[model samples]
Target: MTGLGTLDAWVGRTIGVGWLPTRRDLDAYQLRCLNETIGKARVESPFYRSLAGWPETSHLDELKDIDRFPLTTADDLARGDPSLIALPLRDAVRLVTIPTSGTSGRQKRLFFTEADIEATVAYFEHGMATLVRPGSCVAIAFPAERPDSVGDLLMRGLDRMGAIPVALPVDGPVEALVAALRELQPAAIAGMPVTLGAAARCMAADGGPPLRIETALVSADSVSPSFRTALAVIWGTEVFEHWGMTETGYGGALGCDAHDGLHVRETDLHIEIVDADTGRVLPDGSEGEIVITTLRRRGLPLLRYRTGDSGSIAESPCRCGSVLRRLRLAGRIGEPVALGDGKRLRPEVIDDAIFAVTGVIDFLVEFRSGRHMVVGLVTSDPRTVDEVRSVLRSHPAIGPALRAAGIDIAVEIAVDPPPPPCRKRRVLGVEHVA
Candidate 1:
């Protein structure tokens, strides 16, 4: 049995070598993982046994003949009792829980054991090794909800690596955060793209402290390239992006130094890109839903869980020497707005349009009906509404698609306002019908 230190050492070595495993190695590892996971599910989880319809199977190869076990939805977890836990309550060493994004109706609860926490820490440490050097000072800009939240995990990892951790909690007024940044003066920063962008704009206008940030890591939401460029200009640093979800224990993939695409943690988990409607696996470089199977979780494990995000896998290895398979997340599958003419438009299209407008701070897109959509934008200047409308009308995707769909675009612009603090904020869509 590998302990936490052993796991950390393995992650460090694997990441140093670019975190890529050969296809043969991947296949063998997957077989072993499938066997262990299937055996555990059949013996411990009555829900899984009923769902899989084969409680007596001794090996996963038998279940592989059936379509990969159906994805475990947030709804399923929320509707079930806590007795669904596969392990004894007394044996669980650690508990890390987070509220879902609530983009869906209700938020689901997630539980992580000590081993699960160790695995998550190992994955993050490995991912950060690609961008962050040891002993670098890291300033985090995220919600400060609990002592054992993701922010705490990041701080602990940085501490273990001998780096200074500066936490700038974003649950308060923007002015207070600006004051803290002036005091900390950390080397690196991490936060949601929207919050970080807003902070950058504030510094640019208020003439605050000189932000000598070397790298800015953005996650917890989809970020547009234009937004990345804007933040880079504000902070005078390169912006890095990461993708993950709560069900995967807040672990997903990381972008390479090239900044072209994200490399999946194939050794830690198996990724399957499947068609959203058909649930059939798609070829590489084709967009579909991202489904993940955890290979290394001991407590509160998930098998073939649907992430509700849309992305494609890159066929070739990155030039950065990482052997892990790369994935390009287009946007969330649930963020698409359905039109009256049976067509759907992704939020990325709208995001790209809004971000193209100069001086735009933060924005939200609301889908009121099949024919009406509103864009609420925060900006420093008052002329932002017209600028936003022009950009939206000029976009090849949003403008032409909306015109063809016979829907009108409405733009609402306002000065910067503080956003409510929450674990997950949906800046893209509010009240999506489809």
Candidate 2:
């Protein structure tokens, strides 16, 4: 079993007692926090107070009683209601506005106080300890220049852990990132999966001495198995996956050395899996849309918030022997685009097949009309274009879907397409031919 570097102990200390908190201990603590959060939300937030059928805090006798609360959807947040904020505007230290994908110009705004950000920093400090040693030098590829940015918070966490942090821009040219890695040769790296995968392939193409990096933390996007395999094969580093978003304060769950599944930050947040259609909470091990409720967040307490991400909670204990619950993520909940013959194009499936190609660095996917898929590639070797096409044709999911829809695949090798506006990658939808 792999060591999690005082992580289990820290969780225990935060929740119940020492490092070995039991399920019962966790349930008790969560119930207390839930009641407190509900009471505060009802009294302070106009949105919560305005809800039609909110029950009194006393109704929540146990953690499962959380189902009594109505689910809060992304539309609720995007409504731009100031009433959603439980605290005064002056009390908020940070405000994050995220444009809802697939929605026309709709945005969800989240507010965070200093305490909320500190909670994230604390979580990062402990979770990252699982990957890096005290004196390790880590390269951060996520945005870091701004105050209260995810990378800046990660840097602070590393500082607390006695590790050195190097800021590498995620949006910068791949050549620049490769050069920085060659110069610093940091012991560990952290970034979105695609950006890190590109850097790894670029560095490998240079054909010099191998980087001494031992571990990596990939987040902010759904990590495909092929990306992990490629990173390990190219960089000779163990990849740890992290699951979080801006709404969760950027630190929700982190994988330990065991790598079976990610361990949730139970002390800070309560996670539930609910059926997407019925809004009914599902049992552990049942895959459904992820629902989250903040147990301790103060700035804006989200009660039974429906996060559109699909995932499940592990029924069994972690092999690493941590009392924290394990979360197995299954990417986004719904299909954004539909193909004919009851088939949908999942970008994650395509990502798996495409990144598995050896010379591929990155690619942009476009779903055009007439059931056609266009892939624009940035590859280390020109020959990879043909190989990528072959891989996609032979892929189990992509092949069948395309064949069923009578979709023809087109490949265009490019020098470099413009970086995505955000860190997460998705398949673009185009209505007409150019």
Candidate 3:
């Protein structure tokens, strides 16, 4: 196994493309990657061997037919044997398995080889290169478990770059985290938007330390622009949003220096925007589900995996000079709140409205049906209900859409808040509360 320092140097030297390759260059690279990936998948993975047919040596264009290759879904893994690893079980240097949080009913078991871990760390290094400079102290507020988890991997990467990393675990009491932040006084912070928002509130109440956070990296859930603005005001820093799934290693896209949208890592992965209803590809700038093909994954590879995210693409080159496609993620496709009308409401819109209400501590929105939604605001403010109603009524899209859907507005402002000490407080569109 390579030392962390050596791996960091190699990543810093050759991970990301300095300049965006031309269309011809990208095409050639894609074809080469496709050939190599298909060859390996066919030879090593039994799941793919039965699904993906052999490719001809001369006709490379046949790879464009995605239908020829069977789609691999989370369900496929649920039914298969766990020992069906692509590489020999003994040769696997390091094995790390983390059951997903189970956002869906079924939990996904993720297997990572030592090489997969290294690749993930390298990806983070490449992504951070756009924002992090040497010697920057990064305060990580994600799940920091012992041995090796995603959070541990991030800490290792930051250390390799000579940046101080403060791992503030989100599992324990919030007061403990507050104390740790005061002691560490990091230059940058990274975590889910909800965690960062709570930390920002703590900082606001305590008149936080004098240190200024230069950049804030947010991930793990959909982030609203209002939440980002609030966090920036509290921390006196810029928030950089990142998008990735547990299955796709760690992160697939990063917010460029422009900060307008996420620049897809074209060199490491291929991205496709397809209509959520039909799998047909959509033109650039159209909102659709995201499908990704991993170019360099050796362990638990994914081919055209449905990400279930709704976002659009920015066709032009980013102001940062990277030609990689930039994505504007709206929200999860299956989770969108359906109005009584044909139209649907994005979760971000509700987040904006919820944050606008003053004296609201924590809240959850439940769509009882297309016609009604219950808003639970955790605040003692007597005027919280009226304020929420006023804001919802004023919004042109929200009000009109709800009216068209025949949704009778039901607002419940609770004086007693729900149990705290959880990672995220706001659970939007929750069908049931455990």
Candidate 4:
């Protein structure tokens, strides 16, 4: 068996097997569950039943046959139609309302049963075990005020592993979180990328004893290369990236020790990469939009749900030798702002360069009419402000994108504390004004 706490055994246990499952066993189990989920959705979900062009009760002969079903989008859920629920509203223990700008202010409400929530907790327990030792303290920096929130579920999982789980306010002041972590001296920390990076920079400036943090689980947003390097270099901790959304019950793929890619929670989700323009499924190692299908979810089973995130299935086998497939995320899709010269500016490109500068905490990018851009930066040290402006001006990606688009950029720096982390970070593009 492979070391480094690979999820192979946990997967076997999830699929009700005593040992690790071979490729054939995993596929067979997925096919069976897929058929069951389809059958259940057909009967219990009004959305599935009313959806056109799909067989009412037909069982998928193979996993590839899923292409026959039509795709589900955020708009479908954003409609707030009760037909999306696979079970009665009363049965749902937790209801998550996600307000999306793309939805014209209509919120996407998700229903989760007690069983569904517990499944996520199970994934968290086994997944987090790889990062933290038993009896170690874990500072959960995500939201945990409500029951069954990602943080609460994480806390429950860490508790199961005999690890002490401490909740740090994700929306509160970064200084407070840094102080709490310093006092707690946690073994592992889990939260969003920007939040963790901001706090790490603050800790580095404090100039105290090195934090004993062993691992960091950064999730709820894309993890930048610079952010990972910052955490590793500053705290001497392994940074693990996690990819998931409320649609996937908040637990999807997670990075193993190899750090090459994230090992997916295949027991619950069957992820596929598909072309954004056409709904065609792409081959392995091909970057495209992420599509998800729930395997065991009962309250609200999703079928071919388009996540609008760009990623690919890793072509190379994991060094950890886990039987599960790995997902290599390429961040969110459609994030590029078109410039006047038909060139495009990628927020991630700017993010990577901005965060590479030391003492930089968090930054916001505002693009106007493809002609001008304002980079609002919050830095721990005022001295780093000049360094950031120089870096952005000289960055290869930023310069070309700006010149080709004929866009002028102004760097604005502030030493004041940054606001709480937003739901998702991206370029704030304004309409091109005449």
Task: Give the top-scoring candidate (TM-score).
Answer: 2
Per-residue alpha-carbon lDDT of candidate 3 for residues 266-385, written as tens digits (9 for 90 to 100): 555777778777777788899888887777766666677777677888877677655456888877767646563457776678777777554554567777644576787655565878
The lowest-lDDT stretch of 10 consecutive residues in candidate 3 is: 1-10
- Colliding residue pairs in candidate 4: none
Least well predicted 10-residue stretch by lDDT in candidate 4: 425-434
What do the candidate models score in CA lDDT, each in turn? Answer: 0.68, 0.83, 0.66, 0.83
TM-score of predicted model 1?
0.85
Candidate 4 wrongly placed segments (more than 4 Å): 1-6, 368-370, 420-423, 430-434
- Report how far off residue 384 is in candidate 1 (Å): 2.4
- lDDT, ranked from best to worst: 2, 4, 1, 3
* lDDT, candidate 2, at 272: 95
Output the TM-score of candidate 3.
0.82
Error of 3 at 17 (Å): 8.3
Q: Better model by lDDT, 3 or 4? A: 4
* RMSD list, candidates in order: 4.6, 2.4, 5.2, 2.4
Per-residue accuracy of model 2 over 1-434 as CA lDDT, tens digit each: 24764887788787767657787888888889998988888888889888866765535887899888889988788886746888889999999988886446788889999999998898898888888888889999888989999999999999899999999856768877888888988999999887888888777776776776789998943688888888888888898889999888899888888887888888788999999999999999999999999989877888888888988999988878787888998888775447765667666888788888888877888888857899999876888889988899988888888888899998888755765323766678733110
C-alpha TM-score for every candidate: 0.85, 0.95, 0.82, 0.94
| Model 2 stretches with alpha carbons more than 4 Å out | 56-58, 419-422, 430-434
Order the candidates by TM-score, highest first — what do you get? 2, 4, 1, 3
On the 0 to 100 scale, the lDDT of residue 263 in model 3 is: 69
